[model samples]
Target: MGNFTKWLGAGLGFTLGGPIGAIIGYAIGSVIDSGVSVQEYKSEQDDYKRKTKKRPKVKSSTSGDFEISLLVLASIVIKSDGNIDQRELDFVRSHFIELYGKERANRAFKLFNGVIKNEVSTRQVCIQIREHMSHSSRLQLIHFLFGIAKADEVVTASEEEVIRKIAGYLYINDRDYGSIKAMFYNEADAAYKILEIEKDASIDEIKKAYRRMAKKFHPDRLQDIGEEHLNAAKEKFQSIQNAYEKLKEERNF
Candidate 1:
């Protein structure tokens, strides 16, 4: 609970207030004082931000808020088909443990339970996260959600539509969205899509794209966040490696 309060919805009071705060507040009520009001704190922040020209990148930060946002948005996809699959639960649990230790993960687990039961504005949530999370972090967030969707080995149309709309709201361009989608989706030119290069792209073009993508998803950028996030970034880094390797083998470049 102490760990979560550091960043959960750290700056979301501007637009959202009720259910989200309730879910988080519900999880850490013991740790957080009942008297402290998010609305009151947010009111001050709102007024201060209005007078400032350079606002802090609260949304772009990969702190407590970013992690919480990931799980909340994930809940939307998990409940999209009106059925909860064991595979999805297992996938989320494993990632949760991997990201946060057992103590914190267990405490935060309750938030997810509440999220699935309540109705959330997925579009608004996406907008909030997009405004705060870095470009690479946003890519990884969607990539993990897709993994959840396909955990049962079949991504339903509803799941696809929900994930697609989330990506759009995050301000992710079509090429970037297609690249992430290609990684999970079964497409003939998935390697090209993952590399964000065209099928007929020259070897030099492919090589350049691979390097660019690799730099963008590098794990070092997440080292300041936490070891758990660094591990996740490593996994994404490997994916980019595999995609490039596949192309290199196929093209003999």
Candidate 2:
């Protein structure tokens, strides 16, 4: 996360394509000077040319670009409540440090601050992320944004609106949105929605949802995302468990 000038281009494996790459170009390049050596990055200008001459590229399963997108998009949620709160900044910093370690986190913080100061289009960002990210990864990203919005311990009306907009633009399914939202908010029908079952669904149906969601969010199932996100997935796993427990208690199961 040092001066991205050295590692911002294809030479450094930042090949998250479409709107995401477009965003990186403007977000990191506008304020930072190019430090990429001519010898290494010289072919970057003809990126499209090379692609046409070569085989169709396969998207990387590596989480590198996903991690970068998290930092950049988290900043958007931070600024959603009208003003940035100190507690929110601390929360984001702690998550950053935990994931990237202190040195890289510091550099990421500097870059994130610069990013939020600009007028970023959330819809455009979502389009990019949706195109490049896997379904499970998108779920994780929304969960991360909710963590940021609740940093001050409460998500304001404005913040919920923004987060919902983000999920919508990401082409995220409505059921997925309901499931994730139920994890944090205490709405009366949250448990039912979290399971993605009808209020009048049979107990067997509820049980099916519980297992499906649990399997979907299990930490072991997410190992491919690398270690950094396993804990986040666990948080979601527990929430799904809790919702099922609530359903059982309500039904005297």
Model 1: CA > 4 A from native: 1-19, 26-62
lDDT tens string, model 1, 1-253? 2334333444333223333444444334322335556654454344433422233333235455556776787888999998999899878877887788776676556457656666678876777666656777777788888988998899999999998898898887888888777878767799899888999999999999999988877888665355677777787778779899999999997
Each model's backbone clash number? 5, 0
Number of colliding residue pairs in model 1: 5
Alpha-carbon local distance difference test for all models: 0.70, 0.72
Minimal lDDT window, size 10, model 1? 51-60
TM-score of every model?
0.78, 0.80
Over 92-185, each residue of candidate 2 has an lDDT whose tens digit, in order, gives 8898888767876776676576566677788887776676567788788898888888889899988888889999988888899989988888
Error of 2 at 85 (Å): 1.8
State each model's C-alpha RMSD to the native: 6.4, 4.7
Q: Over 4 Å off in model 2, which ranges? A: 1-18, 25-58
